[model samples]
Target: MTPNAIAEHFDTTRQAVSKHLRILTECELVTQKQQGREIYYQLEIDKMKEIDKWLEQFRKIWETRFNQLDNLLATIKNKKNE
Candidate 1:
């Protein structure tokens, strides 16, 4: 999408959207192409897959911690009942 359309959708200024687009371009998350006078940005699906892989590692860590917390809470509740 064009930067202006993205800015309108997010209720943000065009400059703000441009800043974020620059960052994403730097990260290789999005690619830009010049079509006449306007620039269009499109998602780089492979780069997003890289992000998904990175996030999955963290998701596993958080899930393990949440399971431990659930066990601790259950233990506390059982002790209270006894």
Candidate 2:
């Protein structure tokens, strides 16, 4: 999406959105193409997939913790009812 479109979804100014997009571009997480007067940005999907793969271990850990928390809450609720 163009910076304008991205800015509309954010509460900040268009310039702020552009600034972040610039950083993302610098990080090689996104790529931009110029068409006519507008520049459109797209995610570097391969980079994102690499990031997701790296984060998968942490995601599993968090999911396990959340499930344990849910089980504890359920036990508390059962104790309260009894």
Candidate 3:
């Protein structure tokens, strides 16, 4: 999206959006393509996918922890009844 479009959606100044776009472009999270006078920003899908894959590892870990918590709670409830 163009800086103006993004800025309008976020209720921020175009300059701020441009600055963020610049940073993201530098970090390789976003890529820019120039067409005449307009430059369009696109997300680096591969990088996003890599991030998702990395986060998936943590999601599995959290699920295990939550399952353990549920088991512990059930055990406590059973003890209370006894």
Candidate 4:
């Protein structure tokens, strides 16, 4: 999407959107192609998928810890009632 379009969707200024796109381009998460007077941006989906998979590992650990905390709290509540 053009920076103008992105800014409209994000409710931000086009200059702000362009700045973010520039950072993404530098990080290699987005690629920019020039066609005549237009600059088009494309996301690197494979990079996104890799990041998602990496974060999922931590998500699983957090889920397990939260489940254990819930169990512990329930046990304490039951003991207080006994």
Q: Once model 4 is optimally superposed onto the true structure by TM-score, how far is the C-alpha of residue 7 displaced, in angstroms? A: 1.1
TM-score of each: 0.80, 0.80, 0.66, 0.74
**RMSD per model, one decimal:** 2.2, 1.9, 3.4, 2.7
Q: After superposition, how far is residue 60 of candidate 4 from its true place, in Å?
A: 0.9
User: In model 4, which regions exceed 4 Å deviation?
Assistant: 68-82
- Can you rank all candidates by lDDT, best first? 2, 1, 3, 4
- Best-performing candidate as measured by lDDT: 2
- lDDT agreement with native, every candidate: 0.96, 0.97, 0.93, 0.91
Candidate 1 scores a C-alpha RMSD against the true structure in Å of: 2.2
Clashing pairs in 2: none
Question: What's model 1's overall lDDT?
Answer: 0.96
Put down candidate 2 lDDT per residue, 1-82, tens digits, no spaces: 9999999998999999999999999989999999999999999999999999999999999999999999999999999999
Over 4 Å off, model 1: 70-82
Q: TM-score: which candidate is best?
A: 2
Give lDDT: candidate 2, residue 16: 97
Better of 1 and 4 by TM-score: 1
Tens digits of per-residue lDDT, candidate 4, 1-82, equal 7777678898788899999999999988899988888888999999889889989999999999999999999999999999
> Candidate 2, which segments miss by more than 4 Å at Cα?
35-37
**lDDT tens digits, residues 19-79, model 1?**
9999999999999999999999999999999899989999999999999999999999999
